[model samples]
Target: MDDTPREEAGDEGAPPGGILDGTQEKSAQGGPPPPARSAPRRKPGKSRDHSAKRLANAGLAITAPTSRALGSTTIGGQLSAQLGTVAVSDTRGSVTQISYTATVSATNFTTTVGGNTSTISKPNISYWSGPATAVSGVGVFTPGQLAAANAIALTGSHTAFAVTSAVGNTSVSWNPTIIVRVPSSAAAGSYSGTITHSVA
Candidate 1:
């Protein structure tokens, strides 16, 4: 039972120049060559601001005015400031503990020149966590003293400050010592007072 009337072959088992040949046919111009399109997919990249930065480096020099020393208790003439913090943490895979804090500003010590007036009790600080060398006393505000304001934590608790490594912008230095005290009834013409130092 086999009818001999068959002549239909447009795309099936018919190869000779493409038409559904064996390997997906390929001859008469692009057909099965456009199904391998895998070059149109890209959407991954968005992040900026490495983060973290704190710098305070300004003129600091207080040790004049007749060498400060009226009488009795005297320790005037002390100024230092070199705290830095520029970090990116690079990538932060682990180990991270960086801290910083110190404050001061008119906690005491004022002078209204003339009219009889004097001050000498709001200047005493000391800190040296890195790079130190400034004559008299040697930083640490006389043992890290701030007297008031409350905000001195250069490396206390909080993992004692740290900077293991992350990637870029890595800096860590501290040195703040400004202790000035004048007793003996501090009172004399030409007496100025103004203290302010902060970092966090």
Candidate 2:
């Protein structure tokens, strides 16, 4: 026998050799498993501002001339006085055939988130005679009646007559005057009125 241990080689009862329970094992140094793979952080919520804009109010105005005149006469003359017509003008001094007109304007605007808007209204006008109490008369005379009696000629007459007596001239004056009246019920704005006349 050799001095080394003898090799007892032949094991006749072991099953045929083959691989079993195969699996991979990671190394001990893989940087803590990639920090446990946390889900991505969510962004913070943001705030928004919402506000509305305001709108402006609307307005209107009306105006015209102060006075108007008719016809004239010369003294010491027997004549037929025909006082022509008097007319009332509009704000632009243009006579409107149908009726008067008013202009409303958007003087300002109120702004909002939606947009700008305007409000509007109309002006009013009132009319009255300056002298509310004035005299009006009519006379009827037959032909040749004046020659048979003492009669007074008249001024501002529908018939042919001469201006004779100077008394009560101020009251007898044919100038028809009118006054513009604005009522308390009227809106906060300007207004206008007119007087119209005709010759007979």
Candidate 3:
């Protein structure tokens, strides 16, 4: 009477295998274990920089010369002439103002070999601005305000006398004198005229 289901008396070593081979396998649908994949947080490696600037401008210049030859005089004699130095330099970048004008071709003093004339007008010519030396830059003109006894009387109606002005970046100098008075009814040869200077 054996029904074939009884091996329980004193079970011998037991490894005849197959109840899913002694079970310990998992995950057909687990929770909270899918969020441990943290290897993608490495995006912090970038850099940059840029900058630039510039500003520049400076221009203008002037220096006048030509008047040094008046060798003889005597006729109610009174002479003084040595028209030299009249300098000005402007380094302009952003501030500027300039003015100087002087002219005279004939107020008197003429001789055509045998037709003499020297009956001067305008108090016998004299226009001066001598004594001003500031050899650098910025707003110049000092030394008794360009004095030669502060003279001004040069006419033949060739009027343009406003000789001084500068506000920024300016070098300056001065010396211009001409005093002649020989009108004892002057009548002789060798006489000429011309003296002009300008700036703006």
In terms of TM-score, which candidate is strongest? 3
- State candidate 3's TM-score: 0.25
Candidate 1 residue pairs in backbone clash: 125-140, 125-141, 126-140, 126-141, 127-140
Top-lDDT candidate index: 3
Residue pairs in clash, model 2 = 53-112, 53-113, 54-110, 54-111, 55-110, 56-110, 58-119
Q: Clashing residue pairs, candidate 3?
A: none
117: Cα error in model 3, Å = 7.5
Candidate 1 residue-wise lDDT at 170: 32
Model 2 alpha-carbon miss at residue 99, Å: 31
**Poorly placed runs, candidate 1 (over 4 Å):** 1-95, 103-108, 113-182, 188-197
Better by lDDT, candidate 3 or 1: 3
Model 3: per-residue lDDT, tens digit, 1-200?
11213222123632221000000111111212465765555556743322221112224434444324443454555566655665545455335555433333334444433343434454676666566644565443454225667756666433223334555665665666666665666643334454555333
**Sort by lDDT, best first: what order?**
3, 1, 2
Candidates' lDDT values, in order?
0.28, 0.20, 0.44
The full ranking of all candidates by TM-score, starting with the best, is 3, 1, 2
> What CA RMSD would you report for each candidate?
38.0, 51.7, 52.3
Tens-digit lDDT track of model 2 for 46-152: 43323221111111111222232211111111111122221222122212221222111111111121243211111211111122122222211111112313222
